[model samples]
Target: MATRQKIALVTGANRGLGLEIARQLGKRQMTVLLGARNAAAGEAAAAGLVAEGIDASAILLDITDGASVSTAVQTVTEKFGYLDILVNNAGILPKLTEEGSPSQASPQLLLDYLQTNFLAQVSVTQVFLPLLKHSTAGRIVNMSSSIGSVTIASEPLHQNGPKPPRLPYAASKAALNMFTVLLAKELRPEGIKVNSADPGLTQTDAGGPNAPYTVEQGARPAVWLACLDDDGPTGCFFTHVDEHVVNNPW
Candidate 1:
């Protein structure tokens, strides 16, 4: 029998790090599903990849919405028999009152963060598991952050520690890490690899235009994790700072 072609779905791929990941995956000759909440943006991003001679198409997916998630799953099922890769890259940093600091942030603010970052991830994974299980080498890559590091957050002398803790965002990522560990353990028997990717501090709209790393540099690790072989490590944290090394657990 001929080897099955891979299909990858990347959320929030209309722009930023997600967009770069989709493009890189396409360069590997896989069919890429550029998922976005907005129809126009998703179409545009998919078109851009198509122009690069990639097999890419837009799938309207709002990870926070169950209806949208179901629709996306159905769409992919009808078009592609299975999904080889899933990148949960959609997230947000709430701008409500007392947003960044844990001390003053309201409970509602924290809930908002969990909804977009953590809860949505769980929902998306559960819905996609059946399709992922059908693949010979299934991979799930969760986009995490260094700010989520409990160790770094505890160090007062550390640059990130002195700054106001982006409490909700950081905590949500920590929860995501735990999810990566638990999910990997459960899926190991099935030969599926589940891991988290910390893109470091990249310059996306949320990270500010002046932030140090470009989107391309920050996206490399997630792309790497998504394409990991069967022998690759699962349920660990990694960053894009070094290509030679991987799974430097947080």
Candidate 2:
């Protein structure tokens, strides 16, 4: 029997780091399902990848919408039979006013962050998990930030540390880290690896121009996690550019 190609679903893959991650994974011979909220944009992204000889297709996946998520799950199931990799990369950065403080952050802002960054990830994982379970070695990579690291955030010397407060985004990622740990344990028996990847401060649309790293550099960690063999560690925080370095303060 011929072996089936692995299928990877990357959320918010129409642009920036998410797009790069999809591209790199596609290059590694995985059939990539590029998830985007905008139908036109998603199709364009998949077309771009196909133009480069990558086996890719667009899936209209608005992570915040339950119907859209369900549709995406069904579409992938019908097409791919199983999903081997899932990258939860969709997230929103809350705009803050002049030197905002966590204490002064609005309740609504926090709720919005939780809904998109944390809750949506949980929902997506729950929905796709059955298909992932079907794979012999499933991998779930959560796109997280070093800012979410309570240890790093608490430290005064670190760049993503707590000198400036990005309360909502940071808290949501910290919660995601917890999810990674919990889910990794829950799925370990089935040979599924769940981990959080800190792509670092890459100069993507999300990171702004001042950020030092490129999209390619930032995309590596998640891709690395996604392609890991059976011996690869799960339920840990790690960076791509950094060698064998597991991120701390998670």
| Candidate 1 C-alpha lDDT tens digits along 162-227 | 466678888899899899999999999999999999887788887778878888888988999999
Worst lDDT run of 10 residues, candidate 2, spans: 240-249
The runs of at least 3 residues in candidate 1 whose Cα sits more than 4 Å from the true structure, single-residue gaps closed, are: 94-100, 159-161, 242-245
* lDDT (CA) per prediction: 0.89, 0.90
RMSD of 2: 1.9
lDDT of 2 at 191: 97
User: In order, what is each prediction's RMSD in angstroms?
Assistant: 1.7, 1.9
TM-scores for all predictions: 0.95, 0.95
